[model samples]
Structure formats: C-alpha cells, structure tokens
Target chain A: MVVRGLAAPPTPWSKSLAEPTIDETAYVHSFANLIGDVRVGPNVLISPGTSIRADEGSPFYIGKDTHIQEGVVIHGLDRGRVIGDDNREYSVWIGKQVSITHMVLVHGPAYIGDRTFIGFRSTVFNARVGEGCIVMMHALIQDVEIPPGKYVPSGAVITTQQQADRLPDVKEVDRQFANHVVGANEAMRPESR
Target chain B: MFFPPLQPVSTVQSCVSGDVSIDPSASIASGVLLQADPECRIVISAGVCIGMGSILHAHGGDIVLEAGAILGAGVLAIGQVTIGANACVGSITTLFNADVQPSEAIASGSVLGDRSRQIVLDGRPGV
Candidate 1:
C-alpha cells in the first residue's frame, strides 16, 4: 500500500494537455512536497521531507503502479520535467510501474523510463534514465544518458566532469563524508521492469 | 515546522534556507551549520554521527552518507567528493575533490583532487 499527494491538480488550467494521474494506492510519506503537473503512478511511496516540484511554468510526469519510498523527491526547476513523449516505437517511452526510494532527489528536465527502481538517497540531476535499470542507493547520477536495461551499482557516482565541476567546493576546509565512497560490486543482471 | 525526531538536542540558527539531511539515529551536537542550495538536494544516511559545530554545504551538488558511515567531529566532505560506505573519516579534515574507497580506513586525514593526483595521507610521514 502506498500513499499519494494531497490531490492531483485538475487539468484545463494549464496549456499542456497532458496531466498526471496519481494512484489512490501509492504512498506519499510525511513532509514530502509535490508541485507542478506531474503524473504519479500507483503503489508509489514518497518518504519524509522529500520535495517534488516544477518551476512555475513546467510540468513533471510519473508513471503508474510505481513505488517511491520514504523521503524520495522528484522535481523540475525553471523547466518542465519531461517524460513519455517519444517519436519512435521501442524508442523508450515512460510507462507504468516505476519505483523511486527514500531520500532520492531528481531534477529536470529529466526522463526516467518505465519500471525502473531508483535506489534510496540517489541523486539524478539532468539525465536520461533507461528502462529496467536498478540505480543503487546513494548513487550520484548527473547529465549522463543511461542505456536501457543498465544496472547502476549502489553508491556509484554517475556524472560527468562538467556536472561535477558545477558544484562548488571550498578549499582548505575539513572535508569528510561517507557515501560516494568507492567499493566493488558483483555483476548482476538488470532487473526487469 | 518539523522538530527533530528526538528531544531538542541542538538548535539550528538563522542561515540560508537549504536542504539539510539529518539522520534520526545519529547525534548532532549543538551549533552545527548545514547549508544547502534551495534548488539542489541534500541527503544524510543512517547511523551517521555529525559532531558539534560542524557545517556541511551542498550547493550545485548533493551531499550523501551511506549506512554506518562515521565522521569524527568537524569533518567535512566538500564538493564532488564521496566517502564510501562504512569508511571512517577523521575529524577536522577537508576533502575537496576526491572519492574515498569503501572500508579503506582513513584515520584523521583529508583526501582531495580527482584522477589527476595522488592523496598524501595527512599525519603519515614520507609520501
């Protein structure tokens, strides 16, 4: 059982015809904030203190039967979070049943394909997420296009140098942090979406 | 207004409004300053302890700690850097631009820079 947001914003108010339909069975946990016109599917769980919103003019979309666990946040800023509007068949369109976990932050414009499991506390900023990919917990995914059926291991920092450089770092400061610390992983098959 | 999960153990004063990820199980001593980008996200994992008078800033990027990761007082993981799972980082050391390998013991030191340079573990004689 999953809890969803307060209510889906009624369509006909925005210029974009496509609107999100949230399932009654999804779980949107405490302190989880949602904005913009995004679709949230069924059985999705959103944890505490997670904020999912779009900038004043854009929309964010989520698929059906997905589970976004506690503290998971997805948002779009200054631009709409885009999903499921592809031109080709088998060209990867967003579908039903995607799962995003606790404390994961997603920024747009971004596309997360169908039936994917984005692990806990993972950060996806400006990237294309493929289908059936298991993005492990605490992974930093930024500005990279993930192929379909790929498995991003836990704590894998998956961003380019350009994206990494965008974040500022103060010099000569005492810096010690866990997570994003490196480790080996066993080869595993991509989970089917 | 979300109060801390436990009793008011510490007080967060006025600062820029950014995301602060606090672990419920971990103890944060008083006078901790955490700054984050209102636009970006910040995540603090489980069973991690952040000591007193510490500040963690996440701007342009996110700050994350995995399960069971321990940080001595005043430790800072800054910018494009990641400390692996179950790794212990000593206090007062600043990590500017590097990723620490998991379970690789780091005793009170700073690891910085990318694939470009080697990290000279602080307090250890002879590079």
Candidate 2:
C-alpha cells in the first residue's frame, strides 16, 4: 500500500486512531499521528510530532517499556512491489523493549531486535538490526546489517550506492516482443494457420 | 460503558520528551535530546553519558548504547547501531547505518568497518 502524505509533514490532528496501545504515564505529542494495524506495548512512551503507518505487508509491533520520541516516522514497505501477497511484501519485525528516538525513519523488510536503543535523526532502509544494538543520531542506513550489541557512532553514512566489491555474473534481460497478437480462434480451424 | 484503547491521534499531549525515559542512573547533561517515534521503540541503558547537544533518534529499529558509552558533543547517528560498552565516539562524529565494536575508539574522519572489514574498528585496541 502506498500512503502519500498530504503535505511535506502531514499533521493529522483530527484523524482518528484505528486501534493503538498506549500507556497512561506515557506522553505523546499533538502534531504526531498514527495509522491502523499498529501495536504498542505497555510502559511505552510516545513524544510529539511523530507519525507511524503500518503497511498491509507487515504488522508494526513495539515491545514493553519502550519509548518513541518526537519527529520520528515508521512505516512498512513491500518486498516485491508488483507480485506478492500482502503478508509477503514487507517482513519488518521489531523485538521487545527497543528504543527509537526523534526524526528517525525505518522502512520495511527490516528486522530489529530487543533491548536496543536508536539515537536521533537516523535513517534505516531495508536492514537488519540485532539485539542490544545502539544506533547513534543522524546515521544513514542503506541495505545494512547491525551486529548484536554493536554501536554506530553519530553521523555515519552507510550505503550500497557504490559497490567496489565484484558482483556475481548475471545478464540483464532484453525485451523480445514489441507487438505480437495471436488469437486462438483464428488458428483453431483445421485450414487456418 | 466500555473504555477504549488510548488513541495515538486523539491525545492532546504527545511528544517523547514529556515522558522521562531517562534512566535515573544515567547522566544526561542539559541540551541533550532523546526522541522516540510513536510507532517504534527506544531505550537508554544505565551509566550512559550524553554530552550537550547530542541527539538519540530511534524508530521501529532498536538503538542500544551499553553501559559506559561516552558520546562527544554534537554527535549525530542514525538507524539501528549499537555503541558497545566503554566505546568512545568523538565530538561531531557522524555514523551512518553501521556499528562500532566494543572498546573501540574511532577517531574523526575515519570510516566504520563493515562486514568486509571483519569487525575491526578504527582506533580500537589491538588494531
């Protein structure tokens, strides 16, 4: 499912929540918003100006005693854009007691483990996060894997944009048919070819 | 009458800072920012020292800084990465989508090791 933001940062104050789990002691912001098919654990705290949307591909799950800070965005995506069941598209999974701070964005087909803390303004797209991992603020993640109990310092950039490593040989496919129409009815007769 | 689940959108008060997720044992100086996404999870372990102007951002992914991790001022990190025990990240250091091994000291302007590098961190002991 492709959800387009009405504005650069859409603040849907009047939008009603479908079904969400929130603690009484937790504090969430006024400008922040959330969509349906999302699950939040207990003792979990949410801050203002944040938005979350769980794609039909996968369910968004947050663990107990976790905190979600301000200006953060979380969403699920499709693994295979054109061909796949709704459940097969995005396999994003978050472990128990994970911590995510402000201005952070996490895309689908990703997995995050338990007892980990993420810093501010970080970006993660299609990656795997192990348990007890610490991602510092302003770090960019592109198709990466964070080891268990490892730390990423602030402002680090990780991307597969430039690959110096040699890739396996795989030929690109070329289109074969420009326009070819063979009607079965025309050739069905004994004399037709 | 039946009660309903707390509406994330309907609530008037929203913002992570309003909730004190800071551990009592952890020492976070003034001007340090800790923010959490409403749809994700975040946690700061004990004995972590965040300098002034440092920001911790998390989302659906987990970000854990183990005990005794010292972050310099104005450091920025993103995504799901762990700062192991006793690791020191320099001031204004930027880490993108990677991890630093435990007890590693990474100097400024250095690249963080990836899967190809075999877990050897710069300025780390025995490196």
Candidate 3:
C-alpha cells in the first residue's frame, strides 16, 4: 500500500506531507508499504511484506531496475544523508539494477551503487557500497565504504574501513548469479503488479 | 500556474490489532504497527509516545509499555518485551524478548536480546 506521510508535527524530515513518486513502470505489490518522499524509478519491483518508509529520513531514491525482495525494510535516520551520483542529497540512494534480497535492511545514510547485490538478511547501515559489489547473506556492513567490485562473504561483519578494504573482488560466478537474479526478478515485474 | 497548499494526498493511520489496550492519553504516530496474537496482550500506558514506522509484535507473550515511555522512529520490539516507565528507546533499535529498566535509555541502532534467538531459519527443506 502506498500512502502519504505524516501530516502533523512531529513531522518528517521534509516537514511536509510528501507522497511517494513511483514511476508507472514500477511494480509495487499490494502488501508492500511505501510512505513519504520516496522515489521509485522505472521497472523497479517491490515484493510483498517490504516497507520503504521515508517519513523520518526524507527523500529516498531507488534507481531503475532495482528489486526489493520480500520482507526487506528500508528506512533512514532523521539526521544524515548521503550524496547521490547526481550530487543530490538523499537519505538512501540505491543505484540502478541493485538487488536488495529478502529480509535485508538498508538504513541510511546509505548509498548503494549501481549493479550491487545485497544478499538475504544482510544489513547496510551508514555505509557506501560501491558499484558491482556482491554482499553475501547475513553480512553486517556499517560505517564503512566498500570500494567497487568487492565481494563480502556470508556472515562477515565489515565495520571498519580496513575490513572493507581487505574484501575480495567479485568473482565471475558471483557476477553471473547476481545478474541472473536481477533478470529473473525484472521478468516477473509484469506479473507482480 | 497555481499550486495549492502542500497537504497529504492520503492519510495512513497507525494499525493496532488483537487484544491491545492503549490509554487515551497515549500518542501513536502514523504507520506504526502494533500486533498482538490472540493469546497475547499489549498494554500502552498513559503518556507513551510511539514513533512512526515502529513495530511492536507480541508473538507468544505480552508487551507492556509503562507510562511516559518513548519509542523512537523505526524501533522494533518483538515477543515478551516490557519497556519500563520513562525509558527512551532510540531509533532503529531492535528488542527481542527483552526488558528495559525504568528510566533507562537505549541508544540508537542498538540490538538487544538473545543473539541465538535473533535468526530463525525456516524449517522447510532446501531453504
């Protein structure tokens, strides 16, 4: 369900009752919830039980062809934001073709670059994930910046810059797998709506 | 071109379900979800403030928020939780089967409770 944000004070960060702006090509499942200053780009698929709430953190951006899988929770703190690729400030900036898998949490100020795949049950908080990175399931990425094309193994806790820097590069199999998942989800966009 | 005053196009109220008792003086923000199972109960005392997008789920036990407690935005409390009087739980904190002492303060993004119980894997085969 897509709804308008809070109308009264203790208002949101934007201080206005901003409704979500979803591109016509995007498919938001009925069970999914979106509220307040959220921008959904073209061909994005939001599955059931997922919530993208921009009430507290205003102005979130989901780039085109992104898939937010089931039970994923995307929210932001009220204080901070990150600069997007376009140089605009956003509470959460998700780049094109990103796949945030089932039950993942993407909390701002967070920036996920293009073609990155965040696996199931992982948490990305106050961090920047560069383009083409593959984060395996059950990983915790907080307060760090991961360089491009890095690979984070499952159950890894990457909190400091050193840990992020020491991460391995994305292998060919991982890239193919991530691409396959994105393609499969994108194909289901028609039926998802 | 003339634009009207900026107002909400639609209003989504907080959802409260099943065996929940909230005092009239308590404040609940929009998009807050309070769900109690049939055998469970949720009691919200006076002067309690539950922020937007906070989720309180009482699965097998009761959840009680004592008087003057404050739950910041996006907080998650699940299963047999009791927030004592005047306690403040910060934003994005997760409390699972935990209890907060009276007048205590929990920091933002804190994850409290049993770590072993945090992840519940599906029982289905090949999952």
Query: Mind giving the per-residue lDDT tens digits that candidate 2 earns over A1-193?
Result: 1111222334354255356555554444445566665666665555545667763334566666566655466766645221122233334566666667545676666667776666555677777767676665456666766666665544555555231011111111100010000010121122222
Highest-lDDT candidate: 3
What is the C-alpha DockQ of each candidate? 0.04, 0.02, 0.04
> How displaced is residue B95 in candidate 2, in Å?
16
Model 3 over residues A25-111: C-alpha lDDT tens digits?
898999898888999999888988898889888689999988999899999998899999999999999999899998999999999
Q: Against the true structure, what is each candidate's TM-score?
A: 0.44, 0.44, 0.57
All models: lDDT? 0.48, 0.51, 0.88
Candidate 3 at B105: error in angstroms? 30
Poorly placed runs, candidate 1 (over 4 Å): A1-21, A80-95, A160-193, B1-127
Off by over 4 Å in 3: A1-15, A179-187, A191-193, B1-127
B1-127, model 1: which lDDT tens digit per residue? 0111111112233122356666676555543445554455556677766654344545446667666666665454544456677777775444544566776566653334422112221222111
Candidate 1: residue A161 Cα off by (Å) = 12
Count of residue pairs whose backbone atoms collide, per candidate:
28, 63, 0
Models, CA RMSD each: 14.7, 19.9, 15.6
Top candidate on TM-score is 3
Model 1: per-residue lDDT, tens digit, A1-193? 0111223344354454344456776655433456555556665544334456543434565556555543344555554344454432211123556656444567665677876666445677777777655564446777777776655544456566443333222112111111122200000001210
> Ranking under DockQ, best-scoring first?
1, 3, 2
- Docking outcome class, model 1: incorrect
